[model samples]
Target: MATFRAELVIRNASVFYAHRFTRVNLAIRSGKIIGVWEPTVAGPEAEEIFDASGLYCFPGFIDPHVHFGLQLGSENCSDDCATGSTSAVFGGITSVFNFTPVLTGAEDELAALYKEVSQSTERYRTNLFMHLTVAEPKISPKKLVELALRYKFRSIKVFTTYSSSGRMTSDGYLMDLFKATRGTPLVVMVHAENDAMIDFREKKLSSDGPVKASHLPYLRPTISEVEAALRVCLMVSEMGGRLYLAHISSGKTVTELYRHFSALLGKSIFIETCPHYLYFSDAFLKGERAARFTTCPPLRPEEERQELLKHFYAGRIHTIGSDHCPFASWVKEKYEDDYLHMPNGLAGVELGFVLLYNLLKSRENEISVEELARMFSSNVSTAFGMFPQKGSLLPGADADITLFDPNAEWKVTLDTLHGRNDYDPYEGLKMKGKVDSTIIGGKFVVRNKQWVSTRVS
Candidate 1:
């Protein structure tokens, strides 16, 4: 018998696998996990060893929805590939899935958009995947399938609102998209909000007086999301298509999902909620600095927020994406009074894992570390068709992993985070769990809470 030698070994850690945590030693070679064995079972010899005692090793976190280098009109998002991905790695994210440029009614724009996105990959510190955005109904189903196969992307994003911005897709087109991608690896990702309902509400609200940030809830009410979600569910059910609903802010929508289509969940349909929705309420949009909390499908009321949390604890929600699109403070400040035109997003990629971990730790009996790994890593990878390879600790998987300190305590501050943005939405909050190190492809990108990767200069 020959001795097995590994390039790297992580020893004496509580490694999450098969929905449970167990003490194990992981051996890696050439950026792949080759062995996960009991410490008592004579582990392979390694050239280098990492003492992971007292740490919990999880599959590296994945932020399934992020907007890096996103542009809206003349202004651009503050974080680009290098800076945004650096922030992600610091947050324990080893892979990110972002969106491609909006595909309007033109076929010619596809090639150029592909080139632009492909060229931007060199700046990414984390593994990057993209979802094609279909803005208009002019794109054919054949074209979408062809693009999905050619690019190896597994999802397409479409908006049901933002009609004024020309990003809204008609119900007819959505149905066609669903029917087209049925029985395929592609999942239809929808920004579920009724455009006509929003427009009507906005018009009605404006008739009363000038709309401020506080009026955000009134402008884009929960009913809009609930209605649109039901519509999407019906369409997917009829057409037998897979779906991923993005940034669900309303608990009422979750209730409606279970009431009507509970069986579809974790099967044909998946739901995603953001940290902001779980933490902040519509009350945050009332006073000065409210613009900072402004995001699409605006934060819900306290009751709804609490309800959403209850469902998450009940295991209804599938994943948590940062929805991390941040503008400089100046950009948000400029729209302080004119929130109707304000950009809709928040920055939390760096805080998402800690936020969820802290919440779960507070109610340790309700959720386990294994479930957290599923929401932050495995479930997302499964939904997006990257499982086993990108989201598991099993042999033959990528050696991407996150080491977390379950007892570490820290407060959110500008000094504790990294990004190009000038402000953090989660600033001033205390966090219990902290990411001690992040490994991608068997290499340390973040060690001892510090980034050491030169890949994203």
Candidate 2:
């Protein structure tokens, strides 16, 4: 037999696969994993060897929700594809699913939008995919599916609020969309919030006084989210469609989901929550820099935050998305006093894994590293049709891997991060674990907590 030679070899690592960890050696050639064997087994010859002793090796993470180069009003978000991808890699994310600009309700615009988004991602260091946004119900379902197949997108996003901005879809339209896409590979993602309730509350709040950041929870209240989530559940249950709820903020939403729709939990409904919602609370919205913590479905109260964490530990949450939309500090400061005009998002793409790992270690001791892998990497890939290939260490899978040192400790600050923004929402927070390196398609994009450029053949 010809000698087995590999381009790269990783040895003596605790590799996560099949929902468990085991000591193994991996051989890679041409960006694909070709061997996963016991460490005692004779290893293949390789040009380069990576000793990962005592490190935990996981499939690279996938952030299913992100908005790179998003434009809101007159100012664009600080991180474009180049900078955002760099931040993602540094945080152990090897791939991302970014949303397209709002659709114009015309089928002809699909190609143009795809071209535009594809061009923007040309400089991304991580592999990039897209989620189509159906802002208007004008495009037919058949065309939506066709376009998705043409573009290889696995999901579509719609909103139940933001009607004033022309982003809301009516119940009739949503139902129609559900019925049309049922039994297909396409999953409909909803920003579930009752628009009518919001409009009424906002009008009342505006009439009473100028809206401040602290009044965010009242302005869009948890009841609105619960009602909308129930409505979507009913629609999906009736139509037998796939649904994904985005950035679930209130614990009440999770409670109501289990209370009413337990049957659909993983079978048809997938839930995603952001790190900000899990870590910070409305308390962050009271300080002078409250605008930095502002995001849609604004942070909830401490009681609700604690409840959310409980459900998360109980395995009610499916995945974690950063919802990473960042604005320059000055841009947030521009509307500091005006809550309505301030953009809704924060920077978490670079700190998500570290923050969550620390939170889990401190609070949920029973939660194992395997569960973290599922939340941060595998489950996300499975949901978006990128499984095994992008989220597994199996043979023939892409060699996208992350090396983590569970003992490493670091403090988060604006100066220590890599995004395009000047401020970090997690500034001053102590992190217990850190990403040691990130490899994408067998190329070292980040090594030793620093980024390095390596071209893959």
Candidate 3:
């Protein structure tokens, strides 16, 4: 028997890996997992030991879709990297891939995008990565190459709507962008929706009277998303490039993608769905608090929400992102009579982990613990090329881990959650399986549901 020493040891934890659970001792040194062995055997000694008995330990979540320090219309996002990442850590996320907006006709588009991302990196407490939005006419395939080769960014975000923010990308240009990133490590993340389809519907609804919250679902129906998703799948398939559909809200789109699953298999086709989609419904859009529930690709019918859960349990949806675009409540109030003007986003980064975990537990068991780990962390890291380093609990991997207490129950409130936003869509809703502790880089940022360290000066 040999003796070894490590900086920290997480002992007797219920660790989820692959498709099952194992009780082991995790030895960590220099912010990396050094080994996983039995505590009773010849194992490493440590300066600090955490007894994680009865708690579940999974790899820290890696949120793939987030907008920090973002602006929508006249409203600036309430959460910046400091606040956003702090909230993220509270929810068990140790790393994030944020979106940086680049508009068309901007001189040196990549440089501008770099500046946006760089500003956040300095403020983020957890590991940070970025995916860029390339505006059409201003950005070209050559620019995409420069982004990938020079910036080392592995993904580009293209939207089919929100032209006001210069977020939209036309079909032709999207295909071109996909083709450009093809055969490379780069992935094209499409915010799937038909701009014209939504425009026509909004105009049709507007003719009746002033736009109201109830008209949201009518203006942007599930068909708009399905049509665009199918199109992106076809283009990516033809181009033989990787594609990631962000914030997918409907089952029809998932069904369409699954139909082409074989064709997209080796091409690295991936899909991301948010907690709001799985839990909320369009009916909420008609509620008195309608403005609070407003988001692009409006939540679909309840049945469709169920269908998405089925796909997730069946292992069809590749990853789950918070799409944590936070805005203040007053931003929605400004659009009272004009619902279309309301900012489309929610503050869910802090509650994402508990919401997803409780959703599965409430529904009859479908996904395994390992599968849950994959959806929240591993798959995201693998998709964005941050794998072994950011998503796994394997030896030599970064010591980013989350300790979850399945028996812990708590009520959702703005005070209980960490974020800069003033409201919580999930407010008053009781949640089970709270994050007990969050560790990043072998350092404790959150312990016992409280922030132990600060990234802000």
Candidate 4:
């Protein structure tokens, strides 16, 4: 009968802990998890009570990759942190691995991007952190890694295919980037594709200006990615470094990593896949949606989509990300004219978790809830060294939590979403589950199906 002193209490929520669902009540105090016990436990003294009846309470999603403060190839778009975080909040994500770049000019963009993140922090319904990619592409890669470390970024991402910002460092340089950051607690995130191969293909296709949707077969081929992975894995072993491949869309790339030659990974390489890559494919390219579906390292055939699903089932795929890029119709106009000209990403943050739940629950009925946690939260946190503090909802972790309705059915459409992008890659696809409520730092950011205007802790 004691009055519990707490900020808030979420009751009657069926919890998914580590994996299995257990009915429990959560007590949060000062933004930290205070207690998780039987729902009948005495109510703690709290400012508010959130009823999560008929819902599944799981650790809020930890999106391992995201980028903001940049536009569609230098063009303005609709959402910034305000709308971006709004989408994340609605999606039940509590933390975002904000992927940032060291701008083209003097590092002034670095300071400005940080400022945007900080200002957006208070407004962000979710916690936002960043990773910086700054190993000089041509110079001493070791020194570039040192500079990235000195800059205090959480991680590093390099593009093996894009060299516009000097992100494509040589293999020797890649090893240097890794060897230098090895024990420094910084993990390397590589886009993982061969720039030279892509360049050759692009040149061969010069006669085909702004290529067609069907041209994906020749442009940015999977072989380019597989060959790059082979090279990086070798370099990683040679340098004793850890690397994570970003948004792998094809089965051949996964097989190349696991079957043909994984000796180079040395057991340190991790795999990441995106939602769009899972559901959509070249099918759209042949239809009216071609422009809406183009992405770098383009989407593969349907068989490949099933192959990725198999990888997830077999545990060969580990980490997952959104690669959430927003390009409004205005920005997408060029690409719409020519598939090859379109920006290569989609707004996937909001729909990711629910889709995964639907996939596992339907096809692979026994996909361990623990496994889901590992891929969505724990695995990403561990890969980035952010565990025990940010990814779990245990008694002592941050009280960031999500309440999902396993039976909630909804159709995804732009009219129903918060991202700035006007088109959704998942439009009309029926989803069987959804996050009904999201709590970050003990504050009910999404309550009764709307955004609440208050901050917690």
For model 2, how does the per-residue alpha-carbon lDDT over 1-457 read when each residue is reduced to its tens digit? 1259999999887889667998888899999999888877788899999999878999989999988888988878889888888899999999988999888567678888888887776678888888899876467766777777778779989999999889988888888888877877788999999999999988898888778877898888889999999999999999877899999998889999999999988778988999998888899988888877789999999999988988877778989999899998788877876777877788889898888888778866657667878988888887776788988999899999999988898889877898989888888988888898999989898888887873222
Against the reference, the lDDT scores of all candidates come to 0.88, 0.86, 0.81, 0.74
Worst 10 residues of 1 by lDDT: 136-145
lDDT of 4 at 434: 81
Model with the higher TM-score, candidate 2 or 3: 2
Q: How well does model 1 score by local distance difference test?
A: 0.88
Poorest lDDT segment (10 consecutive residues) of candidate 4: 101-110
How would you order the candidates by TM-score, starting with the best?
1, 2, 3, 4
- Local accuracy of candidate 3 as per-residue lDDT tens digits, 1-457: 2577989989877986543678878888888888887667877778998989879988888888888777877888889888899999999988888877665554476677677677657699778888866668565765665655677787878788866456688888888877888667888888888888788877787888889878887888899899888888888877767888899998878987787665564237888999999889888988788888888778999999988888877778889888888677788877879877777898778788788777678654677667777888878888887778878888889999999988997899888888889888898999888898899988889987788988622
Q: For candidate 1, write residues 259-279 as lDDT tens digits.
A: 999999998999999999999
TM-score of each: 0.97, 0.97, 0.95, 0.90
Clashes of each: 0, 0, 0, 3
lDDT of 2 at 363: 62
Best by lDDT: 1
Scored against the true structure, residue 254 in model 2 reaches a CA lDDT of 96
lDDT of 4 by residue, 205-266 (tens): 75656566567656787788888877787777777768888888888789878875465442
Reference-based lDDT, residue 218, model 2: 86
In order of lDDT, best first, we have 1, 2, 3, 4
